[model samples]
Target: MGLLEYFRLAVRALKSNKMRTVLTMLGISIGVAVTILVVAIGEGATKSVADQVNGLGTNLLTVHQGPRQMKLTAATRNAPTQTQSTLTLDDAQMAATMFPDTIAAVAPQVRGNIQVRLNASNAQSTVLGTTPQYMIVNNVTMRSGRFFTMLEAQGNLKVCVIGNTTAGNLTGNPNADLTGQTISVNRDDYLIIGMLTPKGTGTGGPDPDDMVMMPVTTAMQRVLGAKYISDFSISCISPTMMVMAQQQVTALLRQRHHLMPPFPQNDDFVVNNQTDLLARSQNVTKTMTMLLTAVAVISLVVGGIGIMNVMLMSVKERTREIGIRKAIGARSRDILMQFLIEASIISVLGGIEGVILGVVSAVLLASFGGWNTIINPMALVLAVAASASVGIFFGIHPAQKAAAMNPIEALRYE
Candidate 1:
């Protein structure tokens, strides 16, 4: 007659079929757990990307050779690889001098892979040819000694800076002071001027602190033996100036490369600011999260179907009881409510169990798999809400069937 009485009846019914109830609840629990885990992993990945970008500072922008490729086509893929870079060291110098107010610093780099040997220890490592401005533009910090001087970079001195991994391999110690030590890179001996502070892998990229850095001039002339610059790192005066700086640099490069309007698509350079990278990363992660969540929700739907099936069977078995209640003063709504409550109770309980399981799974993944996982409180709420909704949506048909049963027919049934 009352809500509490209906709930009691519902509980009694579920308790009567203990094994069935448990199995149905287990289904819901598994579904909810999977949804939570997938969402948390996606959120963690997105956050990791943001943090990595922030670590490089907000004002940073990178200029690379060639236009930004929006898509890969057969023609583009089959095109010959240009041995010459459209971006040159002079371009970096011009950018710095042209935007003295907007640009704070510019660091041109020449990149190559080489074998580095220090006495009996030898290891293959990436070699970066950069300028003194690299330390400022890229926010590089030294653990020991200091960054190479402007004079050293301009004079093409054979001084180098070692990353944490390089230091460890060369000296067998990560924290060892290797300043003033000699390490041969590609058969060319270079004096270690500084040891960089450790910077872990960021945003799925290689570890910053695992390379050997020297002057761009020295790398081009004596190391990589190339003339064209690889890329340039530009730091704006402030975060607000990043957009202006990017536009200025783009326009400048276009003019320098003779890329006029109607032929702008043929530009031979691309300028990417930090915000652009962050937006792209977020979009990718969002799509991935939605796809995974959809797959996980399918299991919840299956669990809901299981609840519906069990409820239908229960109604058939309790036909005599339903007929007797209808023979008395019981109303159709009361019967419907009773069965609906039973389904809700099962789903809610399963949802609670699912939350616990999901949290544990996320923690285990983060600990053992070395993954980043962050379980948002909203995810818990969403899982529980989804489970409850599933139960109601699926249970309605069975509840309506029980309420619509003919009393006379149900009463005479075996």
Candidate 2:
């Protein structure tokens, strides 16, 4: 018989057991849908990491305190609490002064979480105390008013700038001009000098727009009560100067800290350029994506097994029909083709439905769930193709079993 004739017979057989056909297709449908959604979520997370890193600028470098044990250990069981930082505000100033040609700007910061209040409104938020150059180094922009003067930072004045989200939380309007007003940070009133433009949510850290910025002197001495600053935000004169700037700053920090050379392994500080940060962040996301994709593949395998089980049962139930067909003019190849076509139809239909479900789910997640989801057209095509391939691969054994039946025995058995 022709291929179309075979397809018609296959459809007729499947239609005769509509409930079984749908139940069999359910595994493949769920598998394909989950595969597509997982991939989209993974892709979205990777992209989010890239955007956050790139937004910080390629010429930027961050200096952080090296790994410190947070948990009690044999080595640290009797040691004094190592809350002190090796980095100091003077170190940041020296890096810029000593390397005028390579280093353009330096912004030293003292950071912590604190309670903020504006009259009756109160919320917990991040507070960053830094120099006036923070705006230049971090590409900060003000929507209203102006950044505090260098004099204010040096004098440790109680003046601050608020981000869009912070303003909204305290004042009930994100776009409200809080400049020239006073807000209480840790119950100390500080004059608001400026309101920053919206920066949106951050990845793997606190929301940038949900924090407040002040002079580093005020933060260390007053707000955070921190004796040492947290980190430095340094900007090179240009992208080309990033490498030289990193080296010069590193040498300066090592000399000033009086660090002995077992080289970098014994060092108490780490300097990371934007490239290094980007690569590290993307690597984490990539690893997570790979793991999730493996789960998706396993689901597809499970679905394929389901198809095999159903096909096997269908072959048993239609034994007499197969026998009668073979007793007439039907060939073994025709019987094989008919069973394969039925399995293919079930998988193909399920795949199409899965694609629809996945796309809609991705969109809903992006909208209501506030997640980033990118549905690549290629992913859809591959998912459908994979389901079809699974159906055929699992259908092969059952098809062969049906084709190999002895007509006389099959007819006489029942």
Candidate 3:
């Protein structure tokens, strides 16, 4: 039979059961839409994580004082939760000095949310207290100025570098350039010698842009007094020294923290390389995305089952029509093609509509819900393949049942 003829017959078959077709299509459509949205969102989040990790060079390691809380763990007899205390400036400097090929710079950080002001302009932001080595550790570049010298840190100068967000809020205009300006942070005068390049925020902390950076000694002595260090950033002397550097830092911190010989988990501090951290985060997201996609696939499969059952009922209901067509010149293959095409048509249409719905949904969520949602081409391909697979798998039994009917007996069927 001609392609048009097969399509015409398929349309008639579907039209005869309008309500059923519509309901089944709706079920399939929703499944496709959800699959597309979930995978796209997953891929987008992965991309963001990769970018942030790459921003921190491969030789970088982050030092956190607290026990990891985000990942699931096996229940222990008595797992001690960590309170931030393991990191200190002494430890940071020691780490930098211990390994020859592994340690170029280390920057200890202490943070607090405080109000910053410039004359009459004011905004609240997280204030970071770190050394001149912070620039080397973070590998961040100034937009149009310079960082403070080591001498300034030793003397505890009241100089600070500000991110774009902090500057905009303090100046009351984003475009107003801030350099060599005196800003009052917590009622103390601070010279803003540098403005940092815009580094967007991520899940790791509040937006990097919405922060104020200051010398570690000055912030500890003058701004936020009386504090143990919370964390530190370690820049390996080079890529080759990363593992040895991590080991040396870990061993020293444990000894200082008084962790006994047999209990490594009792060590409160964690030394993480940038790529390792990114992989951990991506693994979690990957599992969640797969689970969501699995649920959608199950729904799609269920919808296919509905289509198969309906088509089987259709064959039984139109036994006389099948017989008439077969007796007149239609072959078994023609009947099979008609039914197969109908099933495929349902999936093809549902898949197309689902792609539109999925992309629209992702864009809407990204804009309104403030999520890092994105659509990916690979996600589209996956949706199409899944939908088609469902159609082909479920349509077979019904098509076979229809093709097997005998013309003489079907003609006699009421």
Candidate 4:
């Protein structure tokens, strides 16, 4: 039979058993839909994480005091933490002014407990003390006003920059219009020089925008009441310089801290290159996405099995029909084509329904979970192709069984 005739015959055969065809298609649809949604969600998660890491500027290395614990081998990888609080603000300043090859700029961070208040609104968030260069090092930009000045940082002026969340809460969620307003930190009013452009969620507990920024000297002396730094960042010049910068920063910090050679025992500092850290994060996300996709594939496999069962039963019930076709001048190839076309039609139809369901599911997930789920056109096309492949794989044995039917015995069946 020609292609047109085979399609017509397949359509008729499926239409006659509409309920069974619909049930089998439903199974395939559900499977495909689940797979598409899972993959889309995983993609969104990966994108969110990538964007968050990118917000930290590219090719950065940091040196800080290590965790005061022995459980983590990571703790020992950098210079060990000093139980005596050995990192001083002066050490960070020296490194900032001296290290210029691989390190572009450095900023020492000091933190202080402060109550941030604007008008009647109040929320307590840690205030950060760092230099004006911190804005560029951190890839930070102001949503309204600009970051603090170098002079301001050097003079230990009382100006502050804050994130969106902190601004909102202090403004009572009416308007985070804090650019010109003074935010009282530690019962001391500081001019809000600039409000940072909103940087969204992070694993660092809250968005960076939520915190307040002030001169490092002011935070250390006035707020923390100590002349020490909590941590520091060495923004590398390029991705290529990341490793060199890491090594250079390690040596520099060690030298500044007056640590002897091979000082593995409780040395006073830590150095981190964010390139390797970001790569590990990407790998983890990729692995999770693949794992979710693999789980979803099991459903597709089960749907294919369902298609096989349906087709096998179809061949058994239509034994006389197959025999009649064979007895006439119809070739086994024709019989095979008829069954194959029917199975493919079932799968393709299911695929269309699956695409609709998947998109809807992704939309709902994005809405409720604040995830950026996007099932791209390519993914939808691939799902349709996968469904068709599933049909062919499952329909093979049944099509063969029908094609091999014995005409004489089939005609004598009651």
288-383 in candidate 2: lDDT tens per residue?
889988988898889889999999999998899899999997899999999999989988888888888889999999999888999989999999
Report the number of the highest-lDDT candidate. Answer: 1
Model 4 TM-score relative to the real fold: 0.87
TM-score of 3: 0.87
lDDT per model vs. reference? 0.89, 0.88, 0.81, 0.80
| Poorest stretch of ten by lDDT in candidate 1 | 67-76
TM-score of each: 0.92, 0.92, 0.87, 0.87
Model 1 gets an lDDT of 0.89
RMSD of 1: 3.4
Kindly list the per-residue Cα lDDT of model 3 for residues 1-414, writing each as its tens digit: 798999999998888888988777776778889888888778878888787788876579889875633223466434556465757778877877777567888888888888988888779998898888888888778886777788887788999888899888877776566888898877889998888888777656778888778888888778888367768998887787888888888888888766665545566777889878889989988998889889888878887887788778878898899889889988999888888888877777777778888889999988997678878788788887788778777887887787778999999999
Q: Tens digit of lDDT per residue, candidate 4, span 97-161? A: 66677668887788766788777778987789999778778887778887888898889788988
Q: What is the lDDT of residue 178 in candidate 2?
A: 86
lDDT of 4: 0.80
Superposed model 2: Cα runs more than 4 Å off: 68-81, 115-123, 184-189
- The per-candidate count of clashes, in order, stands at 0, 1, 1, 2
